[model samples]
Target chain A: SQQGEEDPQALSIQEGENATMNCSYKTSINNLQWYRQNSGRGLVHLILIRSNEREKHSGRLRVTLDTSKKSSSLLITASRAADTASYFCAVGTSYGKLTFGQGTILTVHP
Target chain B: GAGVSQSPSNKVTEKGKDVELRCDPISGHTALYWYRQSLGQGLEFLIYFQGNSAPDKSGLPSDRFSAERTGGSVSTLTIQRTQQEDSAVYLCASSQGFGGAEKLFFGSGTQLSVL
Candidate 1:
């Protein structure tokens, strides 16, 4: 089953602009992961932030997790047209299964 | 070799027909998972397998859906008597282990169309 919800279901931005997506969950998680999916393709793991870590960075991607608030956010800096796609946040709990959010659709206009 | 792979990129079958979708996970990965994503819907977990132990089949939707991982490697998801509502993308994901720190590597998925 799906674990959470993502706000601003769709966002449009121009190249070089920053894009931000938010996710909120109900249960405590060990970690949260961000993934990107291009049209008609599979998802690619972008970055992962553990519960102990409030924030993390990978290349142009920045992810922030707030355990107390039970929410997380993904920020893409200097967005490119190639970065246009759907972004999803998967929360990992003590259980082995990973529950995902509805995802945010990001469109970067060139 | 670096990512998960799936077969038949697309599959179209008539109602009441049975279809098999295959997934070849990353080499040496100990955990594999199956998920189904209907159009405009969040992915639904179908099943998961870890090593040689019993699979976690709690997420399967119905008796029509079943999966098996052979030799702890390649896996297959079979849907019997498929219905129009079953049309969706079947995704396969695998990880190094069943741990909170493990990140899943996903396959492109097979787009199934049941008519």
Candidate 2:
């Protein structure tokens, strides 16, 4: 069974707009991470938010974790054409290892 | 420093054949992982190795899939008697330590096509 699942399988937005992706998971977690993958390529780590953290920010990426709800959200501010890619949310258990969600495809139009 | 590297960026093999995929992690990394990504599917964990400890083989989908890490630096994933369902991109990642807190560095991955 998948631990995490993202909503809105595909999304399209104009440049300078904001994009939001949500992930919900079952079971407790130690941390949740977001990763980006280009077409037919490996995933690149984006940001990680620990369970103890309510929110985190990196550049234009903002992540929020709600342990009480077992959910997380990734918000990309001022989306650019370069931000077009697949975004995935992964849950990290206390013991280690990650369980990933299906992912959301974001297309930023110029 | 070089990033995690995978060999044979792409492979096309016949069903029932065996294929070996290799991964060389960044120097000094003590943990390695293998994952499979199918079209429209999320990354699936296959196996994990950390230092001299035993590998976590729980994620392997079936007996036909196996992986091993040598000298805690490089790792290899082998699939025997492959089936059409085995066609997917095999990705390898390495981290400085075990568990999810450590940032993982990924390789471009080997796209496997089974005919």
- Model 2 lDDT tens row, A5-109: 998899999999999999999888888999999995889999989888999999999999998888899999999999999999988877667878899999999
Best by DockQ: 2
Question: Which ranges in model 2 have alpha carbons more than 4 Å from their true place?
Answer: none
Docking level for model 2? medium
Root-mean-square deviation of each candidate, in angstroms?
1.4, 1.1
Superposed by TM-score, candidate 2 places the C-alpha of residue A5 at a distance from the truth, in angstroms, of 0.7
What DockQ do the predictions score, one after another? 0.63, 0.74
Per-prediction TM-score, please?
0.95, 0.97
| Top of the candidates by TM-score | 2
Best by lDDT: 2
Where does candidate 1 stray beyond 4 Å?
Answer: none
Candidate 1 CAPRI level: medium
- Candidate 1 C-alpha lDDT tens digits along A3-110: 868887999999999999999988878888988887746888899898899999998888998889988999999999999888888888766778777788999999
lDDT of 1: 0.88
